[model samples]
Target chain A: MDFWSNFLINLVQGLTTTLQILVISIPLSIITGFILGFARVYGNKIIFYISTGISTTFRGLPLIVTLLILFFGLADLKIYLSPFWASILGFTLCGGSYISEYVKGAIQSIEQGQAEAARALGMNKLQEIIYIILPQTLIRALPGVSNEIIYMIQYSSLSFVIGVKEIFSVAKTFNSLYFRSIEIFTTVAFVYLLLIAIATLVFKIIENKLKIT
Target chain B: MISDTILNVVDLHKKYGDSIALDGVSFRVRKGETKVIIGPNGSGKTTLLKCLNLLVKPDKGRIWLGNIEITDPRININKIRRKIGFVFQDFNLFHHLTVLNNVMIGLVKVRKLKKHQAYKKAVDALSTVGLDNTLYHKYPAQLSGGQKQRVAIARALAMDPVIMLYDEPTSSLDPQFVNEVLQVIRKLAKNGVTSIIVTHQIDFALEIADEIIVMHKGRIIESGRPTELLSNPQNILTKKILIRNFRTLR
Candidate 1:
């Protein structure tokens, strides 16, 4: 096969893997964030402390360390995770921690009266959070969550370290084989840029639709 | 408990870091009666209202809503709250929701009404509060303060609560808007919706109150029919509060 055609086929294959990671990880991370954030804010003392600890520990570690630990370090304990699963788990923990920080702040910024009003109307704690609090928190946390998503796309390249052959990894392999360093890497960079641009536009549209006004 | 009494409070006491908010405050409201509570700030009128619904748990008190001892830890507070509608001074309308949805939420979520039924009830309650159809789809942020308070009232009213609690329902409104909210409350009062209102508006209180209870320093200083209390106040503090309201209004 010609160099450009061979490279394009491999790049497309790698792009699929990257999209898979994002499709699964984004929702997982968001769910993780809401649970941890809400637990820290409104949970009982024991739950609050535990959730706070989890968020703090994950956020403190670098994403690369989290991925490495999940993929390789856990093998010492005979806990096996595939490179793909390990990458997903690591991204979820790290990204979720940061998202939870935004979630926590957003939840706090809502007036106490909002919760009180829901309670007065006989909504249980869960109902209040689901129907009233979460909707408002999501809107307030959107800007920060959007930033995390953009970062997630960029950092997803790091998964190649764990042997998950995503976009950047495909380009790196092509570079070694053809020694076309500039061409291969620049194409990879543009792919990431395109993905982030699309993500940004999607989030912008959501933010506009959900604007309280 | 009296057969017709909807709410009964006995020896309610609350202290926020040694500043006594409600000191042995006690009161009762009969079915379909409007009992107006007048007091200065920090005098515990708001605190008393909160304790009735267990929003602010009393440091020491026993409250009976209908026949249930709501203050008891084993009892279901949510069930009790469903029967009692609370309107906050600031309106506290769910800002993200349209006026219609704001009223429909409690009906659907708490009352467990069907969507169509809840929507119908919400519309009825909104109309009862004198809100126009044009405002139904608008968010609370798009409405005037008076309109927001009316929506808040409709939100509570849709639950078909046995009693309504108003904590200065019009205090957050602009001067021009207060009368609209007051009119809604007056209409509800005339319709015989049992309520306990805490307000600085003594004139409105006198007009609608079956009985007026005066509070001072976290205690009920006096209680009687509005005319009787106004004509012959039993406490110097009551006279001063009534005088203050008159001066503020004038």
Candidate 2:
């Protein structure tokens, strides 16, 4: 009973850090994704090439390598960032690139006639995109973005490697001290499952609410 | 150049790769004149309308909306477009918005009308297109093809455009629903809404057209008053189109 209580206390504290990272990272990643996606689709040639390069470079690199470079490699270059900030920057860049691909695909799936109608109605290109196109694109992109968000949640554990005592890291510390690998790891897995299930439900509710009749 | 001419096209030409869409097409539409363009497929009727609305840029031509030369690069296309309404064949209503919002969007966004004013104009336009208040809150998918097209027309009309362009507006509709859209166009034309309509419905065109222009192979093959063209067609293609598509002429 004492072991369970101690583990639960550590679990709650670790979860608070994990939730903090997610709360900050998710919205930043989504904003980054939209900017990159919009540039790829409607931007001029130079902007298209630049955004495509950014998306490809980040998506091609492993998330661990990105986090390590951001945290350690940047320190060598005299650009120090806190472990928490480095993890956020890494996740946002990598996750946003993947999310951008989904956004590009969704934007393309919208009918050409839709844009033509808005332009014919005297909407400037920017107004047409914001008012006529993005609303529909976001709904189409929700499932893909939700998948990315789930991946980000699972990967948030990696921040523990950089000294953030999130759930997985806390579990590792407790297992080392008490040698209760089964109990500690099992609890961590459950925590991740719970987070993912909650995320899926939240995304589904959003999709349903925004869905075109 | 005529004082009454609201739109004029001079030596209009367009090409997509090797194929010519419009070649040396020219015409003038007087204020409140309903000009109907009839042609076989690939004859540039739709392209001509798109050019006048500046939706398609003409490779070689000059177009004037009133005294302003629209083909000039300095002209703001968006500003010109606001005054020229276009109703597409497929309706192209914004699926995400309600019927009322679809019409109200342009009025608010382009015309800068307040929400209440836009709502009033949208409802009036919807009413003019024969759509009742009951349909206002429904989405595009919830409406039938006819109702969707009516909403598209109301969306354009709510802008209070100086001229309206219809590009095969009823071609996608079921036969039973075609007359309803045509009736709206007929009513608008009778009220003296200047328009250029491209359609296969030659009979309806004859009824509303102040003058009918027949196009073939990217050129104006013939044009005249409805009765004159029916009585004496200058081009064989015109006679063939009139016979094939015009039920009354047959």
lDDT at A107, model 1: 99
Candidate 2 residues B105-126, lDDT tens each?
9999988999999999999999
The ten-residue window of minimal lDDT in model 1 chain A covers A26-35
| Cα error of candidate 2 at position B32, Å | 1.4
lDDT of 2 by residue, A68-91 (tens): 999999999999999999999999
Cα misplacement distance, residue A16 of candidate 1 (Å): 1.6
TM-score, prediction 1? 0.96
Which residue ranges in model 2 land beyond 4 Å of their true spot? B247-250
For candidate 1, lDDT tens digit of each residue in A77-137? 8999999999999999988998999999999999999999999999999999999999999
- Model no. 1, DockQ: 0.83
Write the residue-wise lDDT of candidate 1 on B1-250 in tens digits.
7899998999999999979999998888899999999988878899999999989999998999888889899998999998999999988888789999999999888888999999999999999999999999999999999999999999999999999999999888899999999999999989999999999889999889999998889999899998888788889988887777767877
Q: What is the lDDT of residue A204 in candidate 2?
A: 92
lDDT of 1 at B33: 98
